[model samples]
Target: MSILASSFHEGPLLDKYNNLLISHERYRAMFDNIPLAYMSMNENAAIIDFNNAFSELTGYSCEEVYMKPFSFFLYDKKDIEYHVNVTFPRFKRNGFARNQPWKLKHKSGREIYVIVHGNVRYDTDGRFIQTHCLIVDVTEQRLAREECQRAESKAQLILDVISERVTFHDREHHVLWANKNARSNAAPEC
Candidate 1:
């Protein structure tokens, strides 16, 4: 018999319960398949769950992280202390913390930057139960920022050369840029 048909004969409570289970499964599927790193911790700051993307980024399996103190992955002593001792406690008291950029050491000994949003979930008696994290790896973004800086430096060097008039722009039919050597060798008119 169809599950919905069975629930219908059982009563509204059964039908509602079945629907809730289905909804939870759907949400779980979406979470597991997400392309970004996702992690969750207990109120005690112990890692409880993480997604596939988290493993891909960190080079650590979910099994290695689960039930362990998440602070173990942090290479910065100050950051580790702040996150485990200060931030989680403040979040438990505050209910939520917005996106905060963090630097962490990966299993390969490379430092990666991530933006994290955390929220504290509470039990019925108002005690903190879990901390949920939505983490996004920003290593590529950091690299891009550095690349832009280098490109700006190179452009400045080109401008400095141009500003000295050591380079010349020539046009008759087509425009051409010539360096000091090329300009000195080219015919004055042509």
Candidate 2:
């Protein structure tokens, strides 16, 4: 009877241990399999750990980036300054920063635009431990936005050079935009 009771107690403990191990594995798999680039850095901003997505985005292997400062990957000095002076302070104070624009230097020597989200972690004693980051590549999106803006500016210039008055109105009949000639040729109100 005593032996049977001891075995039953051990079974539940073993099952609980196995469940803990499975949970850890699941967490690690999810971290690695996430589509966006993910990285963890030490308090000094040195690269400590990174997921496969980060390796793919930067075209850099873990060996190449291990223990390197985050600024080592930056494409511009101004960006480094911004990170140090603005982003870092805000992140430290608030424990998080969202959608911060960054330009990183790729292994192929090209600049890649990214929006970074970062969260700081603290130890049980409330001491800063590390920062975890998620990075979304925005190079294509930024380029598309710039192209659209340039096209709009060029169309506006064409309208300004024309002799005819051109006015753009919204559905509410409010003037959105008017060419220079249209603005100048407007009649005085009755």
TM-scores, each model vs. reference? 0.68, 0.84
Q: What does each candidate score in C-alpha RMSD?
A: 8.9, 4.4
Q: Which stretches of candidate 1 lie above 4 Å from their native place?
A: 1-21, 153-190
Model 1 C-alpha lDDT versus the unseen true structure: 0.80
Model 2 residue 183 CA deviation in Å: 1.8
Q: After superposition, how far is residue 122 of candidate 2 from its true place, in Å?
A: 0.8
lDDT of each: 0.80, 0.89
What is the C-alpha lDDT profile of model 1 across 135-169, one tens digit per residue? 88888999899999999778656765653544444
Pairs in steric clash, model 1: none
Q: What is the lDDT of residue 59 in candidate 2?
A: 89
Choose the strongest candidate by lDDT: 2
